[model samples]
Target: MRTRQSVCARKARYASAAVALDAAKVAGLALRPYRCDRCWQFHLTSRTKGKWMPITSLYS
Candidate 1:
């Protein structure tokens, strides 16, 4: 079932993670599927790698 989180994020909901991954590939977006705790539905998100820095770092 589709969830409100999907609607809010403007992303399509898939029946399974595999389906979502397929869709992401078809769309040419490097995305990873993850289940939302709030909605309990699979959603696609871009895979990013970075370290969290303090807000003050931006100005320094």
Candidate 2:
């Protein structure tokens, strides 16, 4: 598994992009998959609906 500076980063490998989309729908989160340049794997990220915020900010 790899880590990203972005707080909302979540990585998961599915057989296909459609499968990933289905999983995201089941979780009730709006997500889309893109090919990672470094790892060359698919990663799902939340659709940007508002201003970008770091996950750490929620704790502080």
Candidate 3:
């Protein structure tokens, strides 16, 4: 039988939320940081729902 890895397992793990958010910023304005329940670590999500505001708004 074959095993499947979870989304959390495949994604990169960040030590802190700040680090994750920073990475997201560098990656692009469309990305955001989110806490993974299983890993207890921060990861970036590309979902553009909710408060997915662009960083450019803060500057302008």
lDDT of 1 by residue, 1-60 (tens): 334654536766787999997998898865777787656678887744563445764574
Error of 3 at 54 (Å): 8.2
Off by over 4 Å in 2: 1-10, 47-60
Q: Ten residues in a row with the worst lDDT in model 2?
A: 1-10
lDDT of each: 0.70, 0.63, 0.75
What is the lDDT ranking, best to worst?
Answer: 3, 1, 2
Candidate 1: worst-modelled 10 consecutive residues by lDDT: 1-10
Worst 10 residues of 3 by lDDT: 1-10
- Candidate 3 clashing pairs? none
lDDT (10s digit) by residue, model 3, range 1-60: 221248878888899989998887888765677777777788888776566586885575
- TM-score between model 1 and native: 0.59
Best candidate, TM-score: 3
